[model samples]
Target: MKWSKSSRTLRRIFTKSSIGQNPTSKGKWGTSLTSHRNKLGTSRVISTELSPSSRRFTRRMPFHHNKSKKEPNGILHRSQAYVAFIDETFKGTKRVPRFMDDNNIVKGREAQRWIVDTALEMADAVRHTLGPKGMDMMLVDRMGNKVLTNDGATILKSLETKDPVASIIAEVAKSQEQNAFDGTTTCIVIMGELLRRADELISRGVHPNAIIKGYRMGLSQAIAWSEEISEEKEAYEAGVEAAKTAITGKSAEDFVDILSDICSRAAMVSSPSEMMLLTVHGKPEDAELIEGLVVLKGPATAGMPTKAAGNIALIESEMAPPQAQVSLTDPDQIKEIVAIQQAFLDEIVARLVKAEVKVVFCQKNIDSKMLQLLRKNDILAFRNVRRNDILKMVHALGGQLIADFADFSKSDMSAATVEVVESAVNDYVVVRGDGIKAASIVMPAPTEQSGEEFQRALEDAVGVSYLAVQNKKMVKGAGTIQAQMSYRLLSGEGCATADNSKVEAARRAFAEALLIIPQTLAESAGMDLMDVTVKLGNSPGLGVNVHDMVLEEMNVFEPLAVVQSAMSGAVENGVSLLRTHSIIMAKPIQEIFAEAERR
Candidate 1:
């Protein structure tokens, strides 16, 4: 029943009770309980005060047992009692019963504070590794493998954290790295600074909604100002500058010119999709770019020729013979099966020889017998090649990938020159001939860790170069663009509806938040942050020269996509973090698994 109707019914039932009637009208000092109940009838008036017996009646009725039947002694039905109790006790309040432990739940301002703090802590881990003067961090995994670098994405991904907020920040940094290719640290630092400003605003009683609105306005204005200040340079010049800017603060810093040349040339020939990395054992100065496919694997057998110049073939299946469906119990049947397998191998080798195929790349392993046959034919074959490598080689060498060895023919082959060069660590097979559009950068380093680090640097360099070439737009780096964005935001040059004080406060906070990048750069370079930020703020084309700890006209330019990508990601994630009002930490999955196993 509806609460209003149930309430009226309850009131009538109470009025008809003996205790609700006038005591004087009853006239008997000691009336029997049965007589009193029999005389109970509907009355217009209800007793303002409840009697002891009526109180006992209400207390004995359990609100939870609302589906039960009516009881004796004129007690109302359980549903009516339940409705009346609910309407009288909690009509306007929003309080709910506690079903979760207080320790695992963080609510209201406390949850917001926790989120901001956790994100800031994660950002701090990569804060110092921001600019040319930035320091590197040594990350050691559980297996005792160490990685020493200043790359923001590397540091964030390598660190272990249980906090969900930290994970979210790390994911945002990773997204920036993937999309912009060179702004992970800048993204995280901007996000952290945004959160810091938001925390301050919240302490002063500003609503988070106002903060989100202000941040959105600030992001649009920053993007617009960035576009206005961007300069278009030739693809080659921009590619070289972008590469040098990307490789400024890593182990490859000393070889920035050489690496930049390699990166620019590779990017000019082909986009990042057609580029690859080949690591070798040597010094960083020995790095070079090859205008062909480079496979780290060599010939499958020692007896095969290490170098061959002829048509190329790609195989997707293994070269081993297929098994017979039935068991061979008789010696004649076994011999027949062996002969069929031998015939299969011989047919494959003969087909390759007929096609004049001298270089073969297979996706799966080749049988020992097949390897011997190819060696006798003087064909260079590499077995167990990766599927990606096979596809790349097909694209670079103008060959078709054959699904089955039985289907191989002269039409599927393409002419190419292949050679296996032995290095200190391993052998590399270089394929250079027809259809050589793709290029690979052969990077050299002394140790495995250093090689890996150099590889990361080369990746960023290549990525930035490709972006710069594709976009053809560049901006001044080293805090110049950030300073300009901050100045424009605070000046309210484009914002027409900047009226409300709370939103204005939030907008100002956003403007200040963007200055964190320049501030960080100045601090890392051992210059006065205020002085450097002031100089850059006044000058449009001047940037921080970390080597000399002075503000000068910097020739360093970064791709416009990098700056825009980082700002957009930081603002979006920062607003998302601020909108969170509650955090419920669930039990760890490992603990849940343990409980399930025990059960």
Candidate 2:
């Protein structure tokens, strides 16, 4: 080969003829021969032809760098080669890699799909527990304890997975539980449906933002339609209906008639913040509503009157002797302290007696001497009552809570008829008289598990009933509002135009998603889902009655607030999840610590 002054051969040139023949054999290389100028203004060419044994050594020399040429496909090509070379040159030293590496992060479509799938899994876990005919789930903990529940919030909260989408769904369910208290399953089911539809539209080339906007539009129409279709009823009537809806599927279903009246009466008498629940061990049939408050504790002493009718006093201060800061070493000093404490007790009793206070609720302990004094005065007293109970008593009887005995007066007391009900297991103080403002539910459960479930059921009932009374609105349930909302959103004529096709697709998807509630209801009740949903789509005010599988105007009613809140919350959360384009999971603490130790 002749060396030209205009170019430099970085490696000895090899042609096909040169492989086995003489080194000077002239063989024109094929199209693989190329030339490029280096940064130093020198022309360079790298051409090689070799046998299998020497092919590993054929690498592009540093002087022949070409930006326009594409790298050949192989493990040892281009960037891979650079990485391998760096690793070989610094084999013993540590080099920090990219953040989260590639394995720990999911981006773009994959991340969105993973989130949608995870959310759907969580939603499905609770979907089977939707509506009145929904089934219950048995949750067993690591210690072998079990809970059977159909409450969506309970089921979602019981899920022990670490998936982020599941966590978000759980949080949304928790919010639903706190706000409306009876629509967690509805909220989660709607969220899953929205995400499913949104994913579909995204696959069909619709933008996520367009889907989100359509969801907002659907939510606005739903809220408007809900308010328009709601019925106005008296507090007690609404409470009765709401309570029935809340209790239909629980273990307390056998007591529906009895509990509905009790819950309604409870809500009618007192506000949600003022009403109290007292659970006792007995049959569910034994549950009753008390016209006034009942404390689980009895009078402080046996000699005190079991029943009295006079003024009720709520004392926040302790009726015991003050703690002596100075320790006494002599009997004389101790006796003096005792006499002073007795005088203090006598003064407290005299004050109560003079004020005509018949009942006393103390937030702190009462000294033994004070109990005897109160007994002599024909007054009933309870000591060490919880602060919450004291507040309830105050709110119930319209009395002031006095923290200082010196501040106690006739003005601080309220009139009440007090009675001590003695039982084999416990004693209760029932206070009922004129001007009493609070109501109490005395619930009897046969077992601890049943008691907890009963409480959960009542909590939902009371919360929704109270909200109904506050909002003064009730919507038809059993997927009535959902079907109507879906139809109205899809009825827009402009949604079919080409200029707004993306938005139109999104609107149509959201409309379809809204029917998932009705579909799930039909499925749960063993009805023909397709037939029921199609009929529901045509009928405006009619809803499926799960008992008969008939599409008609059923008497199921839910609070308007619950319906609107569930729809809005579900859509907002679904839009939020759709906007998430990437997810990067952090390394476990153990792995981080190990890596640090190695460093």
Q: What is the C-alpha lDDT of each candidate?
A: 0.78, 0.76
Per-residue lDDT tens digits for candidate 1, residues 1-599, read 11123431233222323332322232122211211111222111222223333321111111222223434434444233221122222212122111233355657876787777666767777889999999999999899988899999999988797667878888998898889888999999899889978988999999999999888877887898899889999999999999999999999999999999999889988777677897888988989898877888978989788888989888898878887579667999899889999999999889899998888888999999889988888988999998988988777767788997756689899888888888878788888885688888999888888899999998999999999998889999998888878877777667544577888888788888888888898898899987876776677457888889888887888999999999999999999989988777777899999999999
Which portions of model 2 miss their true places by more than 4 Å? 1-107, 140-145, 158-165, 324-329, 470-472, 493-499, 538-542, 549-553, 582-599
The local lDDT score (0 to 100) that residue 272 gets in candidate 1 is 75
**Candidate 1, lDDT over the whole model:** 0.78
Evaluated at residue 61, the lDDT of candidate 1 is 16
| Model 2: lowest-lDDT 10 consecutive positions | 80-89
Worst 10 residues of 1 by lDDT: 31-40
